[model samples]
Target: MKRSSRKQLQNRRAIWMSIIVLTGMVWSLYKLSASLTLASASLPLTELAVSPGKNHAAPQNGTSRYKILIDPGHGGKDPGAAGASGKQEKAYTLALSKKVFDQLRQDPVFEVVMTRTDDTFVELEGRAQIANELDADAFISIHGNTYKDPDVSGTETFYYADDSFVLAQKVHEQLVKSTGFKDRGVKKEGWKVLRDSKHPAVFLEVGYLTNRNNETDMLSEAHQIRTAQAIANGIKNYFARF
Candidate 1:
């Protein structure tokens, strides 16, 4: 073969090799750029939060706290029910109501109010009136029960208006699980406090006071705390859906 012809062929081969190497480098760079773009697009929300306490925070542009009204069933001279342990329903109701109220007050998410904070007489009509006047988001009247059989020991939750059903169901479900008591199930009743309230309202009969075992359990400090926690959790769960 001639030298010039051989030299031309060698130069052409070298140029083709360089072109192949350059093309491979360009393709690798493109793939790396694509990977970086995808990583940036899918970054975690926590990493992007500009302020402290904003991580995983829900959008609360103009949300306001919910107002809750609690009514102790009976107070003052009106003892709605009597227990085997010689405790009046009024006393137990007031105590439990306060506990539940305190539990809910821990979070700034709720504005808590009680019909009767102490052993003071407040009529059924008056209770509903307070809730209406305050424009409460929800109302719950707490009570204890009594029966001749004394064997009937369980929790009872009642709702008067159609809007009250969801609150009753949620609170009752959580109470039943927390207390590990017989679930009497959610019921419907036209109690004055419930029926008259403009906002959603529910009545909770904690347990049959006539039952010695239930009466003792309800009076326990531990059970009261659990009961209060359960009610708070239920209320929170109810609001979470909305």
Candidate 2:
């Protein structure tokens, strides 16, 4: 072989090796970042005492409707996570909540109350207060996930209360099954709303907005409906186990 050809071959191999090394380093950094993200965020706060109030629901089949509080995480000026192009986590949560509320309202067994029906911000403390005031049977807060590593994607459920574990498990299962997203599983978080909620409460990190595929799927109307139905089923299933 010619010396010139050998030199060219050596240069090609060096470039390829450099690319391989760079890719490996980037991937290792991403894995470490993702592990840190999950590890750093799990904590749960104790419950609060709030005043009680009336629920507007007529009895059906000798049973009154279960008051369910549906909270869409962040709204108004607070766009929770801007992890995708032209997509805000707050918007996704609101959209999903609306669909969930719609599904629940159709059932005479549930009296659903929304934290915010439109684009608005309700204080985190106020959200918990509302649920407590109604003496809600269950409280579900909807949210989207975000991570520094855009590839990290899944459905994660969180709860601070003991009674809320089943709620989280049931909801998380249905969400994972319906969405086909990776299951991050049920976790514990000291988020103000769930921590302070007087009744069984759970927070759902529905899908990761940082991931392009997950974000794209989350934005779809069909996917949103499917997610809503799964959640509604979970809520019903949770109550049945009592």
Query: Which pairs clash inside model 1?
Result: none
lDDT of 1 by residue, 173-242 (tens): 9988987779899999987888899887889988889999899999999998899898888888766654
**Top candidate when judged by TM-score against the true structure:** 1
- Index of the highest-lDDT prediction: 2
lDDT of 2 by residue, 145-183 (tens): 898999899888999987678789998889999999998
Model 2 weakest lDDT span, ten residues long: 45-54
Give me candidate 2's TM-score against the actual structure. 0.73
Give TM-scores for every candidate, taking all chains together and pairing residue i with residue i.
0.75, 0.73
- Clashes per candidate, residues 3 or more apart or on different chains: 0, 1
- Give each model's whole-structure lDDT: 0.85, 0.86
